[model samples]
Target: MKLKNIVISAVAALTLGSTLAEVGVGSKATVDAASINSTAQTYSYVGTSYLYKILKAAGITYNKFYKDNKITYRKGKPEGIVVHETADSGATAYNEAIFFNREWSNISAYVHAFVDDKQVIQMMTTKYGVWGAGAIANKRFIQVELAEVSTRAKFAKSVNNDAIYIARLLHQWNLKPNDAHYDGSGTIWSHYAVSKYLGGTDHTDPVGYFSKWGYTFSQFYQLIKYYYNLQGATTNTSSASSSSSKTSSSSKASSSSKASSSSKASSSSKTSASSSTSSNSTQAAKATVVKKTLKHNAYIYTSTGKRTKTLKRAGTTFTVTGTKTIKGRKYYHVGSNKYVVASNIDGTLRTLKHNAYVYDTVGFRKGTTVLKKGKRVRTYGGRVKIGKKYYYQTSVSTFVKAGNF
Candidate 1:
């Protein structure tokens, strides 16, 4: 029985050794597989109420076959990065992944990183394929999900962070601008764009969020272009020192010079344009008409469309005789009442109904002839006959009758 146990242990050790040898020391097997597996499993369902701190601290069980580890190829090369913004506020990575897997049947493209204000969570390996870029699924691309509430400030910050992250990632990947999702033939497209291409016609994502931050799709493309230009310039300079061949040196130098010049021109142009745009934006903001409110005592017409009297209390109502516009807005004139501009009214003013008197906080007096149709009408302390009997102003306050003419 002792001999049997020793033999079994030796066989097991041999099998484990062969497996380790096959995976190699430099391979991902060096990391704890269980940890990675746990992370992969939990990534499918993060939500608003999720405690990120707990998840961060928990153990991850690593699975090499997970979306973060699997890479599928259509041709030979990987695609570019796809940018996305989750429309749901306070969404968690786990929930998003679960939704994608279940409802979308994992049919959707995969994202590599989930970014919020404070941290970037890596859900998948950059080398592997994740469902990030729609019908262009087979194309290798990194998808970054930005966590942000859809407000102007948060949107701006998210855009800035996205730009910085993408720029850095492209730099690391040695990708050209043309290789970016928005630039090349197999360029990166939004979920909406992909949905349209696939003939399903129901998807929009980065577009809406990017637009909220004042970036159009084309502008986003230009940003990628800018980064690519920077990367290309760096590469050209690095390669320039390696070759002793005169022809290669000359070509490299010429190309480098042109690229440098172009970069400078582009940078200057962008700076100037940004400045002009900001200036115009500021001017526009300043030019907006601010609403101002004014409080004063005025008699409102209630009944007897022609009579007007001084109102001393809140509920006093009198007849409004006419209407006029001052400073480009309309106001009602009670009999012998001073015209007050509608723009100066504090609260929402209802349309003045004929023969209706709204009580005023202010008081108006009778026999005061205020302007009406470029003229004036004298208001006796009582109801004055106008064009109609019912169309007269009535004083809600004490009224003194006018003397006989």
Candidate 2:
């Protein structure tokens, strides 16, 4: 209820160059989800069902508690979940509930639930609008508060449970986790994001609070996407294996990954060619580009940018390859459908790390199974954030924990 507890300064620092237009509350941005990340899948999640149990035990129900407390509700289904953190340090879920219960102003701030390490207490129903995300977002989204924790382990537990709670909501809404990450239209947004993307209040909540422990929006969404994928009937490992990713490496990663690609190409032969083909089967045929410089030693990934083939040597002028684009960025597809940024090349070569692992996607999901580990996995580029952990997106979904590499 108190805006002073949260600050919006952090949002400005993070979105320094963003071109986001001011959108009023209840407005929806139209964009394709595939342009950012692949559509998610669903699988069994033990936490999904357990969150309900915790909510029940905490005596959180709309009719039994929320309506009784005189909280308001709108007559509609929620489109998404908006994440918030009580800037009140170490605030428990019960404390948040009690605060919400007593805030008797003419236009009081309210939300749907408050989550702690062991339990989720529902403060209101998602079917109706709550007063949490300003007048605009509160009119649409189901706002949830994350109670601050005292330690890293506690933070992880509390956040993981929040993921479960959010996953259940997404499933109930018949949407995917990554659906929220959709271009200009992702459903899962932070309080800061709410202000930036769905303008109203300028509160920079969860982000300001979470980043203190090295947590980031990138990592927070990863957990949501991971949990959302759990609601699927099957895994979508193959969905993102062919996509563009962070810029590639130049040194050892290139040659090692290239050699590994060659080995796979030779072994798979028929299958390799088909698999090597761009995810866009009907992509316009590209003219064979001859020996061009490896140039920047950029990462060579699958056409989709989901899987990294390896790093290309900077000075080594390998066969200049075909070109294509995933969303809008152009890429040169070399041997089979291996890819590198058209701009990330130079007439050069070198060696960096000796080896690494290959993964299926850039996220931290099970569908991102390790294709290869130890050796053979030549990664280019740097680390990516995923749910509070800074993991080197070694290749695709394969990541080495921050301290591992």
Candidate 3:
């Protein structure tokens, strides 16, 4: 019986493996699979989550990433990676991307990435479940393809790349290296392991192929864990960088770059140092204008809306009165009837202002876009009113304040 077992194992060692989520995990592509991650790669991410934005920002792209709106989006907190083998030795990673991008592939399969000796290509996103493994396995794992090469050396390189790439993904999801072996609970696994554990698929893939190079699932797990630990530590560096960026922004705020001369404290040539307290109190008592940041360097006009000797600063705030409309244009009362166009705010979005940005909220969201500073926005028409302030409807969900325009 032992000799028979040995013979069976020897015979099973020769294996080759494939998914364009429907082209399934083991199929040939019409195009060279080698070209998928090369030349122009895929950046197909579905859903409008910030994750997609971040992935794009990080330069992590997938050209073939897609979502079938027909399929009810089943969300999963991916606990681990489910590894698979594209059994075709001739099939390259690029071809998998092409296959996954379509709905007409022969096999109904899906996986996250395809790795070969030359490159690692992602075909889909961790955000969606592809029908690579059986439904059970697909529910909880991010499936990846490790392309089988003709030569052992290339196969080993591909394995190495898979380990590195999967490790990075682990770090991205804040997952640790799971020690559970196919309990359907570990952080990573082979397609065969997940199939066995979860009863997800009938096909026991990658096993025969991995055995060819004396590679074991256990070894791959350990390699990925090693890299995960390395990258998990490096992820903390981004926090340090964010802190540094805050400090830099503060420094710029305090410098002349952000604030102008008029906005500087103790720049008063109008008030004397000696007995200046009474003078300041009298000036304060007479002035009822509200303070605001200079959206740009502009002369502060007198009560007649004429330019005063005082030029408002950029980041440094000055004052404006409440809201008022004049000549069919919305304007803020900077001092008494002395008004500044609401659109001329330092960050004030003038209609068609060069580099003026519109945000997702009155207090904007991340990711800024520049607008043209061409036409002066003097429109008094507004719908969204909060307290004494008015807001223009930028979108159904977003608004820009007239006070801050």
Candidate 4:
């Protein structure tokens, strides 16, 4: 019986060895299979997030930076950074800086820094917090706005600059890197997160903006972590480069060049020192008159560009009493002191191919209201990419698939 058991064991071992020899454990087929799986995992983000491409593109860009002394936070120090995206799709960081610097009081919004593909313009110091997210977030977070761009490479570069900037700020504040969680526990918070958990504002930015490029906040958090974990990556504010003095010089030169550009509107010389006083006298002189229907919900602002309490719905017709330019964009005067963006009126007509649902600017369904098939509608005259699809703006906070029309 023992000899028979030994004979069976030897036969089983020989069979296993024969099977291994036939398959060849380290054969070309096995190596190829492993290589394909690894490649699949590595390039999974190719068409979507561009994370793989960004990870290999460059180390860190030496961006143009500027600093200013502004109002300090109520807590004397910021606990984290709030990420924001400029609502305007075409505005650069310098362009945004010019507008915010000129109209912070009127708009009641200001951020510490604005980042674009080409530069990082620090409008104010991180030691101070600006009225960016809301009362609560403003007091606790250093706000930074990422300007939207047109191309993939540019977007990659812009985000690289943005992540590096966030990392540097976190390093400067001695705050550890953390992704914002449901409970509002983290050193990195998005404007959307702030609105969701800390509610002083209603803007859901960066999230929608990132979706347009197939990017997500999670990927951004990963990038932030990448920079934060580097050995000497974020040791100083001038960590954009090794030479602090050179960085300062370049920043000043870049800002001065922007100021000298004629394409940029001359920022309002009149400052709003007192909220009670208005800056209408410095506003653009009235030019033309026209009447049009609002294509999207329009916010009525004072003649001095201060947003008022009024919101006009789409499909409402109004007489544009006059026209004026603010920060180089046209505004239609609807009343003695009321104004709205001129583009908000004068929409492009379309006929619905199917029943359409209205979506918000961030691609969220506004309500149950649906436009029936064959119905004629007007769009805000441009297509906005929300997620991977294009939508036509029917109103502020309302959109429908462009294909549906």
TM-score of each: 0.37, 0.44, 0.43, 0.42
Per-residue lDDT, model 3, residue 130, is 62
Which runs of model 2 end up more than 4 angstroms from their true locations?
A: 1-75, 104-107, 179-184, 234-405
Error of 4 at 103 (Å): 1.4
lDDT over C-alpha atoms for residue 308 of model 3: 55
**Model 4 C-alpha lDDT per residue in residues 243-355, reported as the tens digit of each score:** 11111101100111111112122222111111212324335454334445554445687766667756554444565555565544556667878877655554456789999
lDDT of 1 by residue, 153-266 (tens): 444334433444565456556565443223224444444444334422233455555444444545555544533332232111113111011111010101111111000011
What does candidate 2's lDDT look like per residue over 254-322, in tens digits?
A: 221222221111111011121233444335235534544332235667755655745444333445445
lDDT of the structure predicted as candidate 3: 0.44
lDDT of each: 0.34, 0.49, 0.44, 0.55
Which lDDT value does model 3 have at 89?
59
lDDT of 3 by residue, 1-405 (tens): 001111122222322132112121233331223332221111111111222343466675533434442232345467777777777657776555444544324445556677776656665567766666667766677778777788755765576567667766776666788844435467887665654567645555566675565555555676566445433321011221110111100111011121121211111111121222321111212323444433333444433334455434222243543544333333445555455444434222235424444422112231465544464542211233322234443322233454444
Top-TM-score structure, candidate number: 2
Please give the distance, in angstroms, between residue 155's alpha carbon in candidate 1 and its true position after superposition: 2.0
**Candidates 2 and 3 compared by TM-score, better number:** 2
lDDT value, residue 242 of candidate 4: 12
Cα shift from native, residue 206, model 2 (Å)? 1.4
Residue 127, candidate 3: C-alpha displacement in angstroms: 0.8
Backbone clash count for every predicted candidate, in the order shown: 45, 38, 42, 2
lDDT of 4: 0.55
